[model samples]
Structure formats: structure tokens, C-alpha cells
Target chain A: MNPLRPIGAAFLRFLEATGRLSEFTAVAVSHCVRPPFYFRLLLRQMIEIGYYSLPVVGLTTLFTGMVLALQSYTGFSRFSAQGALPYVVVLSMTRELAPVLAGLMVAGRIGAAMAAEIGTMRVTEQIDALATLSTNPHKYLIAPRLIAGLTMLPLLVLVGDVIGVFGGYVISIYKLGFNPGIYLKSTWQHLEFMDVFSGVVKAAVFGFIVALMGCYNGYHSRGGAQGVGAATTNAVVSASIMILISNYIITELFFAK
Target chain B: MSAPSNPVPKIRIRNLCKRFGSNVVLDGVDLDIATGESVVVIGGSGSGKSVLLKCILGLLEPDDGIIEVDGLSAIGLGAGEREAVNRKFGMLFQSAALFDSLKVWENVAFGLIQGGRMDRIQAREIAFAKLADVGLKAEVGELWPAELSGGMKKRVGLARAIATTPEIVFFDEPTTGLDPIMSDVINDLIAKCVRELGATALSITHDMASARKISDRIAMLYKGRIVWNGPTAEIDRSGNDYVDQFIHGRAEGPIRMEVRAP
Candidate 1:
């Protein structure tokens, strides 16, 4: 009946879960680097994670860029600092918004799919079948996903950066009655290479997190239909949370004095 | 009970014990299968039959037991040894557990291409041949698992299991969900497949008809222990109350179903 008992039990459960996840992550990473690589599976995953996600990432970033320009102009006009609008829009899109937004979108899309597919496999004994077939589930199912996610997200974010900046340019020139050439010049002038570089690095880490969480949740799912449903929800939710948390840590590493 | 006298059984289990918390699912179970011999373990739901099979298959580790395949201990085997042991096995799941992402032919050819490192072309040919052995056409192999019917899925599962020509094959409730006729057909296919390959067969099922049809020897598991073991021909006269009750499908017997109010 002790009140402290519940807290101790909860802490123990947390420790147990953390230990399981750490072990799974170690095994997944080891399989990623090992040989007898599945080139065909990796290619398919790259197309799934990267090529198919173009429209979502593109549309999300494009609108985000346009809104940032308008919001910044309104805030800066009172101080007669409206000229800083281009710098603000370009930096925000590259440094934070595009990567984080695109990451959240892809996590909802790819991460949920990975969980549902792998979760179904686990419940149906297909994962155990892989082991019987002399194929490691980590190698056949997870490593390809991790590899594709790590490699493809940066590229998606880079493309997003361009489209997002262009959205801001469109708003500034036509809607806000600013000179197109000057806006572009201003955006380019104040931008540092580190801004884009840090975002790309964050995108890569987010991609890995999304894939890892999806695979981890799905691989461990038990029971049946309900278990898979829970796994899918966990995959998307956990991936999104991890993306936001990691984004800040990477930002601090790059931007903090 | 002691295992039957065999010079070197293909698979041997002694003092096998497994439990989930306070619920003991296997208690000091012992059994043996000789080379090219077919054995079926019969038990009702919750009788630990599947757990016994899984322990032998290395899917679940028994808390205490000795499992030997070809005189090599299967428990606690290193990765290389485990993979080698598993390479000799093919299992037909109760659900036919095909990879929905792959076409039927790819599922059949998976072990050959992935495990044997054979080229796809060669593997596909062998896959088609295995499918033919299970009375399936080449065209059927092109379809995905979801497109197939329940019976077709079982046939494809059998084809996949035998495609690699494994030395040992395990069937986990192979005909559980099929119609009576379909079950007989699957049982026939199983017997034919096992005979053609001269493989050691171990099947677990609640269906007495299936056990009688596919097994040379039958073992009855009750409450996590073997209550009876005898040749298939002698099962009808097993003389044990549990065996008689199960084979007859009687509601009133020594075995009672646990149906407690939630």
C-alpha cells in the first residue's frame, strides 16, 4: 500500500523498456554495417522513403515559406526593418521549418506503413518464417529501412529548402510588392553554409529515428489485430516526438554560443 | 515415459520443461523421432503441443530440457551452429504465413535464393516444380498471397516448405482452418511431400483424423505431459482414458475445458 511502490514499479518498467530498445538499436545498426547486403531491398526502400515522399515534402515546405515571409514583414514593418524579411524567411525554412515539417509528414506516412506491414508480419509468424529461411529479420526487414531513411531524408530536405525559399520569393515579389532581384540577393547574401548543413544533418538523424522507431515497435508487437493497431500508432507518435527532440539538440550543437 | 528404442533418433528430447509464470505448459516431456519417421503430437487447445514443437524448432527456449538433432544439442547453440541447424528445417505454419509482399513463387523460392544462395532463375524453376508437386500450376506462382484462397494458401505453404528439400519438416496445425475435404487433401499432400523427400516429419494437431493420416507414431499430450504414445494403428486401442476421450471427441471425460467467467 506504499505510495512510493507505484513510482518504483513505473521506474523499473521504464528501465526495462529502455534496455530492450537499446539492445534492438545495437543489433539493427550492426546488421546495417554487415556484409551480404540486400541491395535490391535497399533500393525498393529508398524509392518508398524518398522518391514517393516528394509531393508531401514539397507542398508542406512551399506553403511554410510563403507564410513566414508575410508574418515577418508584418512584424518588422513597425521598426522599419522590413528589409530583413528575406533573410528571416530563407533562414527559417532552411534551418528549422522545412526539415521539421517534412520530417513530421514522412513520419506519418512511411513510419506508419513500416509499422503496419512489419507488425502484421510479426503477428502472422512471417518474421519467424524468415528466421527459419535462414534470413535474419534485422537484415531482411530493418537494415534496409534504416539505410534508406538515413540516406534519403537529407536529399528530400535539400529539395524542400529550394521550393520553400521560392515560395517566399513569390509572396515577396507579387503579393508584397517587393523587387524580385533584391529579395533574392538579400536571401543569398545573409545565408551561411552552416544553416543548410545543420538542417541536412538533422534531416538524416530524423530519418533514422523515424525508421528505427517504426521497426522497433512493429518487430516487438504481439497479440493480433489490436497489437498491430497499437504498434502503428506508437510508430508515428514516437517518430514525431524523437524528430522534434533531436532537432533541438542538433540546433543547440550548431547555433548555441 | 521413455523414448522408443532407436539407434540414433533424428530428433531427441528429454526432460523438457517450459512454463509461463505459474502456468506450466510443458513438464518434463520426452519424445524422439527416428530418421524418415513421421510423428504427430495430439492435444487440445492450451495443452502445450505448439510450445513443445517451438522449443524443438528453436523458436522458444525450454527452461529445462535436452534437445538433440543428429546428436548435437540444439539448446544454447552459437549463431553459426543455430543457422546450420535451422537450414536443415522447413516449417508449415498454421496460418500459411506467406509474405504478402512477394508473389507466391518468390515465397516458395525464398529459402533457396536466400539460404542456398541460388540464382533467381534456377530458384524459380525449382519453385515451380515444388508447386507442381503440391498440385499447383506455374501461373499460380505469379499471384500474391492475398489473392489466394484458404486451400490455395495451404498448398502454396506446403510447396514452400518442401522447396528447399530440407531433411526435417514441421507442420504447425497445417489443416486447422480447412474444410474436411481440404484437410484430407492437405494431409495427403503432406504425406506425399514427406515421402518424396524421405524427410523426418513432426506435426502437432488437435485433429485426430490428420494425426492418423500423416503419422506413423502418435503421442497424446495432456496438461503439459505425454499421456499416451503408440503407433498410429494402435491409437484406437490406446486404453488410456485421456486418449480414448480425445479420440472420441467426448464432452464428458477425464479432460475438462477451463471456462471461467471473466
Candidate 2:
């Protein structure tokens, strides 16, 4: 009986924390519409959270596409179905790998950074300062981030999709001895607009989740340095989990027969 | 001071209560701040001083209370109303919380340009003027917050707080982490600014020197309630043991440290 007590306490804590998060999100959304937009601050956040994250997302997608081609080639060649390599690579990149990998990467990079920056601000009473100055922190801080996340994620995914397809193209033509034209044609034929659209949409949602979790944890962080570090970790973990869960739900919506 | 006969307190709290789960931070706290008076709330760390300030600012909702500013109830106000109320106040944070992304002048002019909807040129002019009021040069307005020293940043924060020329100002731990000389400088600047603007000021600090220097009235917060409140000159004769021990920074007093066996 005593052994289960700690588990029950943890569950209750989880419920409390979840309720707090919901309240925070509600406040953030309300603040989004108010006036006093800080366009300059928003542009800076976009550059940092979106543009600077391109290299890592790009590199990850490229390698992922290349590996998919190599593995699919090996498996299909056993059945004399090596010709399906182009379709497999393009489908995987456009449908799942591109968005998921890009999301995970940005979740680690931008999510942690947002949490640290905001958490530090919280500990130092900067958020309070904003309120006292009559500036809504949600409008000034979270809205710009939410807008940037929504806009930048799709852009990042589009870039990743392009790089991923190029990765497959290079591997197939040079290493696998496939006709470049035929491989390209097969990829174009097999991929649908829905697939690309769904992936990009998922990127937007993932970006929102990442930014939301980072901001929520940061704004509510307590204590000091330890609290900030904990918030950063929580942002990454929560963003990653939400991305995976949302990906499944979106897939179910789009692909359920 | 002659009574203005307009019975509205500058800031009023009646039966204000705040609780974080089972921990009560403010318990049935009632206070009145008159117009153009500088009141300092002195308390030990973790004594709910910040919580009281936050409640007044509407940053934290009091579980049970009525907080009124200039005769308007701030609690449960709609977004527009709350914003209108906030526009009448300014704040200087403990660490001079300037926005790192903005130039110094932009930070000061943030409320003017955004909330007041003034044009950029006009806002910048007023910002430069306010910066000058805080003893900062016009060129210093071009620098980022990260590029400024602690004292300089505090001055910029002061400039930002007064940029809109609000009727009330709140200073949270104004001298918590400053050198004595810098602390004195900030104290003097605060006195000068409040006098010049004729603004009502509410400040929270553990620094006795700061309290003595800048306060017209001093209120001691202990255990989520004000134990002693009177004119600054009466602090020495507060005749309360808690006040006596806290003012002298004595360890062996009625205030017990929550130190557990290690």
C-alpha cells in the first residue's frame, strides 16, 4: 500500500501541472490579439529560432534520405524489386521523415534556447518589468514566438524536403547505378500533393507545440538556475512527445481508410 | 498634508488573500496608499512582499481581495479596462530588466510607442529626454541593454519606468544587488525623480538604508501581514521585537531559520 503512495502523489502533481499549462496557453492566446505589437522583437526571434536552425535541419534530412535509399535498396534488391527505391525514398521523406526529423532537431535547439531565455527573464523579474511598463508579456514575448514558429516551421520543412529528395537523387544515380531521369520521374509520379501538404502542416503544429511548451515552462519556472535548466529539459521533452503524438493523429486523419 | 477631500486612495487593497496550494502568501491584507506619498514595504526574503506587489499589478490573482487603483476595481476587469488601468503605472525591476533585443532608447520608448501609440520620432525624442533625466547621454540610447553596466542599466530601467510619466511607480527590491555607493546613487535618483514628477511610489526592499533614505512611510511585512507601519522617522521607535531584530540584521531573534539537519 505504501509503495503505491508515491505513484499516486506523482499522478496528482502531473494533473496540477497540466492544469497550469492549460491556463498559461489560454492567457497566451488572449494576449495574441491585443495591440502594442513589437515587430522588431518578433523579427529578431524569427531570425534566431527559424533561420539559424536551417543548417542542422538540412543536414539531418539529407543524411536521413540517403540512409533510407540505401536501406530500401538493399531490402528490395533481394526480391528483384530495386526499382521501387525512388518511390520509397521520396514517399518516406515527403510523408514522415522530413517533418519528424526537422521537428525533433528544432525542438532540441530552439525549444531549449527559448526556455532558457524566458526562464532567465522570469527569475530576474523581467516579465514583471514588462507588466509594470504596461506591456503584455504574452503579446510582447509569446505572440512573436508563436507567429515565428508558425511561419518558420513550414519554411524549414520545405527546405528539408528539397534537400532530402536531392539526397536520394544523388545516392541513386551515382552509387546505385540508376538512370537519373527515370528515378526522378518515378519520384514525381509516386508523391502526391497531400503528402507534402500534410507534412508541412504537421511542421506548423509541431512548431507551435515546441514554442508553447518552451514558453509555458519558462514563464512558470521557480527557484533559479536549477529551475531554468529543468525548464529547458522539459521544453525539449514535451515538444518531442507532442510532435510524435500529433503526427500520429494527423496521419490517422489523412490516411485512415 | 491637507486632505484632498477626494476620498479615493491612490492604491487600495481590502481583504486581499493569495494562496499557492496549501501555502498562504498574503492573508486578509488591507492597506491604503495616499496620492503622492512614497511608501516602502520592508520584509525579510520569502515574506510575501513580492506577492503583494504582484497582486496589486494584477500579475497574480488574489484568491480573495479587492484591489482598486484611483477608485477603479482592478480585480476581474476586462482586457481593455485592465490595460487602461496598467497605463497609469510604471515599474522598476530588481535587476533593471531591459529588453536585450532593443536599443536602449527603444526600451524606454516601448510603452509610449506601443501603448500610447506615439510616432517613432516623437517617442525617440521623449525617450532621449527621459534618458537625460536619468543622467544618461543621447548617444547611450543607441546601445543594447547587454552592453550597459549594472548601474547604467538601472538608470535605463528608471528612464523606461518614467517614460510615459505615469501617476504611480513601483520599485521591487530597488537596491538588492548593488554596491553601497551605487545603492546610494539609485536611492538619490529615485528620490529626485519621484519629487520631480510628484508621483505616488510603492517600493519593496530589505535594505534598511534604502528604506530610511527614500521612504516617507515604512511598513514592515512579516508572516504575510504588516506588523508595523508608520512614518520613516518612527521606524527606530517601532517598539516591535520583529522590527528591532530585522532592522539590526540579528540572527538570534523571533524569526527562525528553517534549517534542517544536514
Task: Indicate the docking level reached by candidate 2.
Answer: medium
Predicted model with the maximum lDDT: 1
lDDT of 1 by residue, A191-251 (tens): 9999999999999999999999999999999899999999999999999999999999999
Question: How good is the docking of model 1, by CAPRI class?
Answer: medium
- Model 1 Cα lDDT, one tens digit per residue, B102-192: 9999999999998889999999999999999999988999999999999999999999999999999999999999999999999999999
Candidate 2, B136-161: lDDT as tens digits: 99999999999998899999999998
Superposed model 1: Cα runs more than 4 Å off: B1-6
lDDT of each: 0.93, 0.89
Using Cα atoms, each model's DockQ against the true complex is 0.78, 0.59
Taking the tens digit of each residue's C-alpha lDDT, what string does model 2 give over A48-149?
Answer: 878899999999999998888888899999999999999898888988999999999999999999999999999988887777766677888898888788
